[model samples]
Target: MKLSFLGQSYEASNPAIAATDTGETLTFRGKSYSQKQFNVALRQPTEELTYRGVRYHR
Candidate 1:
C-alpha cells in the first residue's frame, strides 16, 4: 500500500502498525522510519490507506 505522512510517501505490502514482518524500520522517500514514527503515524488521524483511498482511522 502507498501512504503519505509528514509530506512524504511510502509503500508497504502490509499496512498494520508496528508489524514485525516489515522489520524494525520502514523506509519511505529515502528515509528510514523508526518504531516511534510508525506509532505516531498510526495514531495520526490523517494516515490513509492508498489502496482503499481512505483514512486509516475512519
Candidate 2:
C-alpha cells in the first residue's frame, strides 16, 4: 500500500499495525505512521490501494 501526506509518500507491503502515544499507526517499509488516516487505512482491503494517483496491491 502507498500513502501520501504533506507531500511525503510511503509504500508498504503487508504493513503492520501499531499503537502510538497519540493513536494507532502502521509500520512498514521503514516508515512509521502516527496519523489517524493511517489507522483508518488499516481497514482497507489488500486487493487495491490508490495513493497519489498510483495504485498498489498485494
Candidate 3:
C-alpha cells in the first residue's frame, strides 16, 4: 500500500500513513507531527489478512 499526504507534501509506502490537517506538519510514520486534526485515507485495500485461520475484515 502507499500513502500520500497533500497537506504535508510527504509520501510513504506501507499499510498505514499519518499526517496533520495543516500542511506545515506531517509524518510518514504512524505518528503525526502537527497538532492540527488530520484525516487518513487508504489508497488501497489490504490484499489479504489472516486471523487464526480466518480471513480478516476485507
Task: State which candidate, 1 or 3, has the greater lDDT.
Answer: 3
lDDT of 1 by residue, 1-58 (tens): 7999999887754445653434468789999876543332243355545556654542
Better of 2 and 3 by TM-score: 3
As for candidate 2, its clashing pairs are none
- What global local distance difference test value does model 3 have? 0.59
Model 1 segments beyond 4 Å from truth? 15-58
Instruction: Please list the residue runs of candidate 3 whose C-alpha ends up more than 4 Å from where it truly belongs after superposition.
Output: 1-37
Residue-level lDDT of model 2, residues 1-58, one tens digit each, is 8999899887866646654465768898999967553242254555677879999984
Preferred candidate (lDDT higher): 2 or 3:
2
Across 1-58, the per-residue lDDT of candidate 3 in tens digits comes to 3456665443455444465566566776788676565456666654477868988654
Q: How much lDDT does candidate 1 score?
A: 0.58
For all candidates, the clash counts are 0, 0, 0
- Give candidate 3's TM-score: 0.24
Q: Please name the candidate that would achieve the greatest lDDT relative to the true structure.
A: 2
Error of 3 at 49 (Å): 2.4
RMSD of 2: 14.1
